[model samples]
Target: MHRQFADLRARFLARKYRTERGHEFACYGFSRRLGTMVRAIDVVFEKLPPELDTIPDRDTVVDATLMIQAFVLNAFGCLDNLAWIWVCEKPVLNARGKELGPLEVGLGPKRRDVRASFSKEFVAYLEKRQDWVDKHLKGFRDSLAHRIPLYIPPYIVSPRLSKSTTSSKKPVEMPSESLTWGSTTSCRPSSADWASGGLG
Candidate 1:
């Protein structure tokens, strides 16, 4: 991954490319990173139990949840960086009629400038998904990045008792435990959405 990123940076910085080529480079980078995130999410889900209730082990549940969250955060980070690149790839006219590139624009303007720099179709798509993004993805990312305390409920454990051969023997019943992460909800974007919007 590091080597891939190094190659991308080298390509992006190559002097032979014109302005349009720069945008293509940014789009290529976004597609590659998005593919990485999708593969990661797939792997994480594959390790998870078929059903949440089937996870009898507490440690396994905790580890799985953490791993999922980590991947989610990474995916969001990739989107945010792509947005920055999309907005900053070209020069924009300033209030004083001066042309400003990414260095002059900085990160502060990227968020607001994205809507203008990005395509109308993409902007509309973002508007449609604004609520989901804000409530689920952005909120979760902010919480993790800021080191905010997450309310992880105690893991619910259900124990299965072995069958006894003796007529007098009885199996012990174990109480089931459940874990909740407060009222927080998560949003998982589909590959189509990523391809359409992130790639666009």
Candidate 2:
């Protein structure tokens, strides 16, 4: 997957599409990548066993959590880039009649423009979940980008024993163990949510 994405990115860069369309293409590419990552995370999570004894090893849990964090960070970055492109990629004239680039528009104006230009449904969704974006996604992204030590709490699993006439064996009783990722707990959305065109 890494190599495939690298090749795709290389091909994209080689074309050197620097126009407004290019920005849109870039946004599309990033969105696809984000979707892929989300799917991969979902697959990993699904592979986790429901039985405590049948749970995957610690390494697997760590890797899965890391992938989740990666997805969250990438989603935030991709969306931000897309918003910037939508808001500021257009050519603007300055006082001296010079064409201002995207970066020249400044962050504040770019954000306002993005909000104003976005679809009504998208704008409403953002308005409703602004706190989640700021607190969970943005906070996690910042912590990751700055290399801050994050506290990853363990995933507690309590597997319920099934009742079947074929098997009379009692379910093994085991205490829940904390699967540490680091300083932070797992912050993953439901896989079904992604499949239904939610955050992914």
Candidate 3:
């Protein structure tokens, strides 16, 4: 949050912070969840190996996986809680015919209510974020929560690569590797693009 916003938030509390208005307190709730996400990630970093190829002990693996799940859930929670901030800023959004919940705020044909409820600029911002979430976060989070739990494979090896590479005693890596570079908007994303913080 910006310093100006922090100052304004204090002013809002001094003036309009009422027990009945749920949104007034939502900013704090959002803050706490964001903090949890950060803490969970830090805990994961401490508990798990930094290198992908280095496996943790079985007990540590279980603990770290739980922390990762916490991190992911809290990230989405922070997003959802922003809707409450909107409700506080624009009370009409929660008025009779336009009640918008946190989960209800999104951009899509099916989410026309969300587009209609927020400003055009806000919807445009949401479009980009939703795309990123769909591509990166949703599948992993959903799978961990609802389907198969997150799996940290010991290693990756395709059948064809295994046959040729395993013949020698040396380790076999790069089962499937392709290197490419172009404008991010035109190219498929790769680790090389994100690790140094470009594509994202």
Candidate 4:
């Protein structure tokens, strides 16, 4: 994985330094393509079933891993599609000034200034968009991929369910007669003791 990343970085940097004469970075290189696949694999592995206590044996682990890998692949493909949408979606700028040409041809100091402004706004927009996407996808992924049936603790469980489990169990009761009251019954109530006045 490290080697693949190194190769990808090298390829990307090579393209970065190359003269863009409309042919430098035309095709996706072998390393870059494999890097994408590796990314998908990583996502899948990360979502593997966490609660393996219920798993019967070693064979089940292997089977679950394969299933998780498939779900991860599907998730990766969805994310890739989203990335493609972002890349392909151009900002619709309605400008009254002189129209600029393509990026390679028209990019200069002034163009760069415009790009910087656009980049700041575009980055914020993309981040917000991705956040919205994540909000929607997290629940779906939790159910379809990362979800594991967790046991409810007895203490944290509802009273009815707990009562049903232990039918013979009895709840502790307090005696009202044990509570202390005033020796004299005919005394004026204090103003401070107006709210929830307990027996003296």
Candidate 5:
């Protein structure tokens, strides 16, 4: 990975991007939230079965589904943090014309100052993108958070199944099979590995 952040920070934008009392280094928040989303995605990928016919392990599948939800939440968090960067940079205002207080902060319609600070094209682009994110990421995360969690069926109906069987409410039963060691175990990194601050 590019590890030149310190070098870059020392060279450029350090003085220019200094935060005011209410402002912050929102880019750091964006990066941290993005990192969280990436880790969630990595775990979700790990839980994914190598084949459609792989053993349907309930625990692993459930963990993977939850991680997927986590990824969506964190992904939206990335956008929220990014929105703060623009708001802080332009120093937006409220109706009273006071520097906008930290209130609802996200890539949503509420952050009107953030939208107004940008060019028309950029604002339009953000609106469309926010719509997409709201539909895809926010809806899923909201459902998982407030309504219902994702449900991974106990069985994965193989795509190789006959059309008739796949069309039916019940998939044709398959024989049970042994799985690899990784399949039977949790996908989480060990505490020691996490303590090392490395991708063990």
Candidate 6:
């Protein structure tokens, strides 16, 4: 696992950083690498997808947050779950028949079992984080969905119209056959037109 992480880190640095000094690290040290990952995750959360933005089913959100959190925290082997119960100090305890109180001890014979039970506080924390992530993701998605494409209008030139009404010098003479019977234009269509039926 350590070797795999090392290989992945090396590959990430090589691809993203691309520098002459290989030992200086692209972004930061290993811990800083985790920080960088968290920051990236933060951006991912901030730009929530439109589909996942709305308030989702509680169970579904819980499941998704657990999966995402586990991956981000590198909590493989189910150790993260255990850590959530024991390390983060979040667990429910039942001491009905026992002398100790709820916080005194956990369920099962061993302390491990006692630590893994669900706790209200921890569940609340997870819910809050999920809410935050959901809001940002939704906003990001909305922005993307409503974004418009850019376009540049083509240049156009229109013929200028003449405003003068007075004749300049003598009007040019027109051929006798060029003028129609009741029209001043030469190209006049008569009743023998091809568009009689109209073009649909």
| Candidate with maximal TM-score | 5
lDDT of 1 by residue, 1-200 (tens): 65665676566445453366346545565545555565655555665544554433566546556666666566675665554554445554555656544443322223444456657787778778776765566565655555452333444332222222233366545434332222343343343333222223
> lDDT by residue for model 3 over 106-175, one digit each (tens)?
3332444545667778777877676677556654555555556654333345556657776888875552
lDDT of 4 by residue, 1-200 (tens): 76866775565445532223212222243334445556646654454434322323445445444554444334434443323322223322225433323331111122332334346666566456554433333333433333432111211334554466577566644343322211221222333432210100
| TM-score for each of the candidates | 0.52, 0.50, 0.59, 0.23, 0.64, 0.18
Off by over 4 Å in 6: 1-33, 37-117, 137-200
Candidates sorted by TM-score, best first? 5, 3, 1, 2, 4, 6
Q: What is the lDDT of residue 130 in candidate 2?
A: 66
The sequence of per-residue lDDT tens digits that candidate 5 reaches over residues 68-133 is 777766665666666666666666666677765556444565666656677888878776676566
Q: lDDT of all predictions, in order shown? A: 0.50, 0.52, 0.53, 0.37, 0.56, 0.34
Q: lDDT, candidate 6, residue 46? A: 49
Select the stronger candidate by lDDT from 3 and 6.
3
Candidate number with the higher lDDT (4 or 6)? 4
lDDT ranking, high to low: 5, 3, 2, 1, 4, 6
Give the alpha carbon lDDT tens digit for every residue of 15-118 in model 6: 53333222233324443444444554454354433344233345543443443433333312122222322422332334553323323342221333343454
Q: Which ten residues in a row have the lowest lDDT in candidate 1?
A: 158-167
The ten-residue window of minimal lDDT in model 2 covers 191-200
Consecutive 10-residue window with the lowest summed lDDT within model 3: 178-187
Candidate 3 — which pairs collide?
none
Which segments of candidate 2 are over 4 A away from where they belong? 1-21, 24-29, 47-55, 88-125, 147-200
Total backbone collisions, model 5: 0
